[model samples]
Target: MMASSDPAVIQTRALSKRYRTVAALTDCTITVPEGRISALIGPNGAGKTTLLRLLAGLARPTGGDIAVLGTAPRPDPAFLAGIGFLAQEIPLYRRMSAADHIRIGAHLNARWDGTSVRQRLEGLGIPLGQAVGTLSGGQRAQLALALTLAKRPRLLLLDEPVAALDPLARRQFLAHLAEAAAGGGLTVLLSSHLLSDLERICDHLVLLAGSRVQLCGDVDALLAEHQILVGPRKDTTAIERDHTLVHAVRTPRQTTLLIRRNGPVIDPAFETADVSLEELVLGYMGQHADGPSPAHLSAIGGDQ
Candidate 1:
């Protein structure tokens, strides 16, 4: 459960992971507050999977430190039980029936809620006699989620859990996820490239690019601090003096500027529009593409 002190549920300082010659993650650091749904996003080959694996204690870091639920990532059974992970593949025994899976879950988890799991599967119209191999992709994903939630974990880690589901299925999955979190103090860290679903469910955001954390903070606060200015194509000398320009694109007639506003935008020539979560994420990613790696940013790990 979340404490009144508001301690960060997950924290990493200079955390790094390497596989032979490849550095999957480099000097990464971020903080996730308890009970918030945080979206971890990045392009392909951006180390998103590697970071999730590290958090799950499936792999050890080559350097730095990471603490989840106030302890370092480890293979301890008790620590593992406190975390419920649903991998992207949605691994399940193809030969087993849905009832068999439920039985297995109850046998493995100390806090498994059999009644809740049974009710969830039944409500979704997943037959207890149906073989896992015969279930649809969406049904399989739902089943995986049901099993995880039944464990009543404090922290839930989902890696692209909805990437394979259809729009309707995605909606249903997120709705169920929201209810689960609201029912208890569940902290979630979900990685996905689907920004649409993320914006609908996540209250916090973490952007990773070039094997580093590009941005991390409360979603609303981050949005409030960023704005996209559209105006005539001209020198941005005046605007640059007041705001941090994240990215800028200019055409013959118009200019679009993605800036982090430090104060009010008093300029009348420029029409400012609220930046959506997608735009904000893309802007940061664009900046990453144009600028140096996050290693150059001295305060990369600090509060945004």
Candidate 2:
């Protein structure tokens, strides 16, 4: 891609971190378009957190390469300068107050905007005089966020940033991400098991399940491609074999199906409705299930 189209962040072919036998990520090729908010979501061990770590350059990729702002990681000044990372459990000096932490943030980030830092936290109603160790989980997350935004990053990689918060607090934190991206063209890639929270903030999705990418694309496009059809139960054969079955449920009276079809459904017995992003994602993840199902979600990783 030309520099104009070149994203500030990219992973040409990033594969990394196998724990003796299991591969965390295998030949993961992807990119983050400049200034867009992308969500990397997956189940507990789906390698979502692992990918976030690699992107932040906290751990070396076991096999392939990754680039941030056109540079490599770990003390790569330009890359480090342009990225602001809020790890899963952001570390803080136990004794430091919110105000003191911002001071430390100012020290590391070359472009630290002190006034902006204070204003952001104050705007959020986070008391600067209180010590980091004294803050609640949600408050601490906000504090970490305050430190990160204070850096004026070109890219922000957040991992379950609001996982510890209540519903209301979650809203407040996500709003911060939205404002940051809109006002300054900040590219953000966040990972969360909280699909609802992510759904509200992300424009793009990267769904990971079973340690590999299942789907990747724009949120609206995926929802448009797959569909849910509700109607009478058939012998599994008569329901319409035209579409690749993504998910199927059989009740005594009727059946609901999720499918990926090349064209329109011609089945007269079925009533088709557009699948929500959540349903589209669940269909992909449930493709191989023998009987039961766990939770499912969507990103934009593309056909499992």
Candidate 3:
């Protein structure tokens, strides 16, 4: 059994899931530390949904182990109360009013905050008397989030929560999410393809590509460890020996490399530039592009 006091709110060891003959997630291992927003990113069909569903206790893994909030994901009411999940569809009863949904949520959650939920809807100008089906996309999104927040969960799992919202609506929703996370004792794991938005709100990142965990770590720490070096075009044999190269490009006049450096650089010919979150994610995604899959590195080693 994993320790209750383990800093990671979620942990998986060699976790995998298969849909018939197709493997959705393979040999996956990762950790999502507590009290911070962690973004799960990957390209289409990269198993982001499968991983999130497993964590949400909606699906069972075919192999390996997973623990949510220190216990195995379970369907028991006591266990379910600790987690709140919002899927990409954001399902709500079409004929129900905002008040009706609030009442239903109060009955369903042991720690439901009805008053707070009502205030959030009202503050957002979501009418209590209007049927949900009549609400705008942005309004419905707000309503879905409010309901989830009212559950007062220990960990919130969001699957592309803002994928359909407009720019202004997306900002508003994230602002509310940030405020809720700031209020202590709540941890969030959200998956999205929007790298720019993730950079704005997420403190930690887990990047999956080809159904594998390519990178996972604190956003700041990972960025600091990986650097982009620009220098004159030369043989990369020596640098490749020390640094784990992710991606490299060269022209007749210059060369630039995205590398995971374990030590201080003493090379006089190269100038190191900071790597952005998008660059880091893309570098890992491109790891398998040019040749056979690169052997996995222990840059930010997984829980396994």
On TM-score, the candidate that comes out on top is 3
Question: What total of clashing residue pairs does each candidate reach?
Answer: 0, 9, 0
The RMSD of every model to the true structure, in order and in angstroms, is: 3.1, 4.2, 2.9
Displacement of the residue 289 alpha carbon in candidate 3, Å: 4.6
TM-score of each: 0.91, 0.86, 0.93
Candidate 3 at 92: error in angstroms?
1.2
| lDDT values for all models | 0.85, 0.75, 0.85
Look at candidate 3 and tell me the lDDT of residue 92: 94
lDDT of 3 by residue, 1-304 (tens): 2223539988998999999999999999888889879999888788898999999899999998999999999888888899989988989999999999999997887789989878988899989889999999889988998888888998999988888999999999999999999998999899987677667889888888778778777888889888999999998767777887777888999999888886977688999999998898877777645543333344223222
Q: How close is candidate 2 to the true structure, as a TM-score?
A: 0.86
Write the number of the candidate with greater TM-score, choosing between 2 and 3: 3
Lowest-sum lDDT 10-residue window in model 3? 295-304
Which digits, one per residue and each the tens of the lDDT, describe model 2 over residues 1-304? 1223645465546566786798988767666778668888777788888888887888787887777777766766667878888988877886889889877877777788777768877887878898889888878887788788888888898988988889888888888779878986688899887577788778777877677776666677667767888888775454334555667888999999887666888778889998887776666666533432332222222233
The 10 consecutive residues of candidate 1 with the worst lDDT sum are 295-304
lDDT measured at residue 6 in model 1 versus the true structure, 0 to 100: 58
